[model samples]
Target chain A: MSEVLTYITEHAVQWGAVILLMLGLYIVMTRGNLIKKVIGLNIFQTAVFLLYISIGYVLDGAAPIVLEGAERYSNPLPHVLILTAIVVSVATTSLALALIVRIQEAYGSIEEDEILEHGET
Target chain B: MERLHVIVLVILLIALAVTLVRLRSLLAIAILTGVYSLIMAVVYTLLDAVDVAFTEAVVGAGITLTLMLAAISLTTRRETKPGKRKGQRIVGAATAIVAGVALIYATTDMPGLGIQDAPIHRHVAPYYIETGPTETGVPNIVTASLASYRGFDTLGEVTVIFTAGISVMALLWRWGKDDR
Candidate 1:
């Protein structure tokens, strides 16, 4: 019990993030709804963002602002990387949504199974 | 105290994710996704990635949500029932579990939270920290590195975003012939 507690205390955030990633994947894999799948993708992407930023954390560190006297700053590289990632994600989401709109217009349904059934018929 | 806060937020995020999965209403899902993004932005802020948090807030919560809602308005709001057979679901679950376990196992090799000597920190990070302000004359190291040290990468990212915008417009733009 004590060991379990120690592990949880040590790695709770990371484990939480990992669980979120799994949940996102589960949704993406199981859901027939295209929109839900997109939401899952967003969740998965954000989980990765969480993991990257968390790795850059420094104990007792201030934000990565350059100051004359401040000594410790959290690693800014991951933050920079994630900034670009966020914009890319938004672009992807918009493109995906636009595609979904077109899909709906073309197939009259956004559910994967429905679209497939229509194709079969 | 901070760890506790992070843990709490993580739990909340999990709860939101579960709810998002269970809910079948697309409108509700869209709103929940926005809320999830907002919470993620807060989490990023707590992790001292303020710039990331800002972008997540704008893109994740703001623009993405609006676009999703627009798409939802154009499509049906109710998701059909799970269409996959039991075997498919089982396979998917197995794959997700294997991947998750692999990722967790991989984390064992990673340096613990905030070790100053972590490999990631030992690399170009130190150089950026030491020279970023002087070289770029920017107080924010992230700004300096993103705009100066990695200018080409930023330019490429901008180009990608612009291409996406143009593609979306081209895909959606219809001639006025239908109305006429």
Candidate 2:
């Protein structure tokens, strides 16, 4: 019990991130709505960003702005990497939304099951 | 105290996720998703990832929400209720649980919360930290690494963004003949 408490206290943020990740996955898996799935995907992506940023964190560290006498800074590599990733995610979301629009126009329905049924009939 | 804040924000984020999944109204989902992104941006800021937080605020909260709303306007606001498939839902739940457990197991191997001597901090990070300011003359190590040391990668990313923009325009553009 003591060990468990120690672990939780040390890694609370990471555990929270993991829970968020699972929630996103659950949303993606259960929802039948196309737009909802996209939103789930966004959530999933954000959770990943959280995990990465958490990994790069340093206790009592400053942001990666190099001041004259700054001693410790959080890992800037992850920040740079996440910047590119964030932009890519936005691009992906835009493309996915555009495709959703086209799907609606093509089948007159945005539900995944409805689109499948329309194809069958 | 900061950890407590992170916990609270994460809990709120989970609540928002639950709400998003329960709500079938597309407009509400879009709006909630925007709020979710904003919260995520705040979380990023709290983690000392200000650059990422700024980008998330602009692109994730702002542009993505606009695009989702535009898509919603083009389609029905309510999702059609499909016949419930209990088997699929069960399978999905099982998969998510298994994946989540595996991820948690992996986290056990990760370097503990904020140890400066972690493997990630030991690699190219040290090199960048030591020389980035001198080589690039930029105070922000992230900007220096992103724009100078990794110029080619940034260029490639910019190209990808440009291509995505062009592709979206092409996909949505209506021909003059169709308009008439």
Candidate 3:
């Protein structure tokens, strides 16, 4: 109905976040390429950051600068949290990439199933 | 309206995700990931989290993308098909659907975007917004909260970054000889 469409349109950002999260999950679960898995994880992490940032938005608010005439501001806590999270995400990406490199060196491949087969033999 | 722009960006994000599913080239996927992060950063700015948008642009789009490119170079850019697992795709889709449904259900009662009465706007955020400048002498509430009120947490975050640096160095650095 029109009412449902209106609500969906209003919270489009939140819905976007959820759908992206699911896409990330699907990529991680189904992708066999190790680098692809990492990409999926990064997408998943970024979607979460979006979810938090969207929560902090305020109506007719400016940036969280405590200046005169800026009567209202969005939440700053999520910004702080996600700032740290972004660094952590890159850290995770780096570590995972290094591991992927090592796997490639050891097993001569980066595919999950190939690595598993190498382990069995 | 401004909301229209956000809708367009969200649509672009979904379109990129679907393309990622179809793309087999690792380098192409990595580049698309960077584009995705950059668009996500713009969306953050529109939502008023400029600090977050800035960091995401740097770390997510910049550093993370570079790292992925390096990783692709070190490994193969060609992605081979998976073994014939009959039900993996179905199971993955089912799992995604279940989790997506749960998240959607949880969101049903959440305050709509930018509503003042939301619980997030009710508690400590008010304290930060009201007293940030006076307490920390920083016009930016995010900087004030990041540096002063939550200084210890920021320190912890720095330590985490430092740890990550150390870890990456340890893992990737060749030390003296080329092991590979």
lDDT of 2 at A115: 91
Tens-place lDDT digits, model 2, residues B28-68: 99999889989988988887889998999999889998999
Q: Candidate 3 lDDT, tens digit per residue, B1-180?
A: 556677789889989988888799999999999999999999998989999999989988999889889888999998997779659999999999999999988888888778877899998889888888888889998998888988998888888878878987888778899654
Cα error of candidate 1 at position A99, Å? 0.7
List native contact recovery per candidate, as a fraction of 1.
Answer: 0.79, 0.76, 0.83
Off by over 4 Å in 2: A1-6
Ranking by DockQ: 3, 1, 2
Candidate 3, A55-118: lDDT as tens digits:
9888788999876788888889999899888887887788899889988887999998888898
Candidate 3, what DockQ? 0.83
Alpha carbon lDDT at B123, candidate 1? 84
Clashing pairs in 2: none
Q: Which tens-of-lDDT digit does each residue in B1-180 have in candidate 1?
A: 566677899999999999998999999999999999899888888888888888889888999889988999988888877754688778768988999999999887777666677888888788888889988899999999899988999999999999999989987888575852
Cα lDDT, all candidates: 0.87, 0.86, 0.88
DockQ winner, 2 or 3: 3
TM-score of model 2 relative to the true fold? Answer: 0.95
Give the worst 10-residue stretch by lDDT in candidate 3 chain B: B1-10
TM-score of candidate 3 against the unseen true structure: 0.96
